[model samples]
Target: MSNGPAGHVARSTVRPNYETGRRGPIRTFLRSADGILIDSVYDPGAVVYGSAENPADAGRSPTRDLVFVVAHGFTGDVDRPHVRRVAGRLRAHGAVVTFSFRGHGRSGGRSTVGDKEVLDLAAAVEWARGLGHVRVATVGFSMGGSVVLRHAALHSGTVDAVVSVSAPARWYYRGTAPMRRLHWLVTRPEGRLVGRYGLRTRIHHRDWDPVPLSPAEAVPRIAPAPLLIVHGDRDGYFPLDHPRMLAEAAGDHGELWVEAGMGHAENAADDGLLSRIGRWAAVKAG
Candidate 1:
């Protein structure tokens, strides 16, 4: 019940400036786990060593460390630079495998925000687990962060750890004057009308859910397994306190990273930030 409907947490935001690098093509594969045919894709340009072609090459070695399952934000595809950057970073650290969430890229199903997406995350984890990886961690950006939190909360003892960047706990809240003004201006009558029937609708898929899955509500349950909440002090959509509130809601169960000038998921490569998360996951999974 941490970041749930009854939770009280102030919202905040930072300046909005996003940039991503040109990504190479994706390596597609169809793998079945728990009866779900997960459409997994990876950056071929990011391939460090070994070949995904040989089934043995894909299998994790007994000495293999940990595998990271990367999830991207809303309206994000696997080809996005942010996704690629994170995957590239993890791969450089020798992550076993990485892939996008269901319905985001070549994956199947309609976006359910964090609702059904949690199941997709579970499937992805099960896929990695089946591959002989001893420990697993998930890194999610924006909406994907919420999905990761929900998955961790539900499967607390199962997952090793979780990291959420620029993920909002309360969907509706005002943290700063500019953020409040922007929220009112953008979510007002015109915004509502547009979202309802306009050309640029926020919820596009027919299966989109109106109810936002409050990850804060799920954070408390993600204990035992470490959780890392990373957010930009300069995020535009959600405020800084959103992450703070999520951290507080998580009690002593998790750690938080409040970067000074980071924005949403689409920022430059912050190897330090990613390294901190990587270390945290490595320690937790170990």
Candidate 2:
């Protein structure tokens, strides 16, 4: 966005417009910058790119050159029902791109949790670009939500807009019961066993060589790029402070929405909320 807060990258911010239709999904496996194989799916919208010969048809569509790149939560993959539902709802606003994180589903490599998963998201965003999309809006949930924030900070000029749903502001938090249990899964042998066998998520054993940037820290760097931080008052893993901290760091550059009676992540996101997110991403990216 604005030279990465004075001397970070000096790259110019990207502002775009968007419009949408729908077709079958095209599945593909792509390689990340780190040589990991990522399982990805592309859902084409109603009108093909460059297919609207008549001006009226083009005017009728609102998401012609836009794409929504969805990043799922921990333990989620491309085939998950919640993820599918999100893609289905977002198709009405633009084309959708969903992919498995490194250690989830058909993707290859162990999960680094939120650290290395940024590479996975980078791969998916690149894949969307190769599909002829000019506008890219990243929509992430939970752990994926944190990843998107870091990705936007590290890979500026790639994403037109960002929507982080239910993300944590900092790292190593153990206040919540679910978060305590999650730390166990990532730090203990038996818990890792359960994660592999029960949750089907293969977690890496090594700790972060050097701790990466936190979501709150990344927020300040995303200035001039539209960011929407959505949170629920009833999230089990993270409390309202998580989103609030992020909003504070984002200052005037980001918008925060505290949904009434909402819970957590993709499992808790309803069709109505998803529709609003889709429409918001379209307008912001455009």
Best by lDDT: 2
Query: Could you give the C-alpha RMSD of every candidate to the true structure, in order shown?
Result: 11.7, 7.8
On residues 23-89, what C-alpha lDDT tens digit does candidate 1 reach at each position? Answer: 2323433332323233454322233334667655563332244778777776566666767667767
In order, the Cα lDDT scores of the candidates are 0.63, 0.86
Worst 10 residues of 1 by lDDT: 4-13
TM-scores for the candidates: 0.69, 0.88
State, as a TM-score between 0 and 1, how close model 2 is to the true structure: 0.88
Indicate the worst ten consecutive residues by lDDT in candidate 2.
Answer: 3-12
Off by over 4 Å in 2: 1-24, 47-64
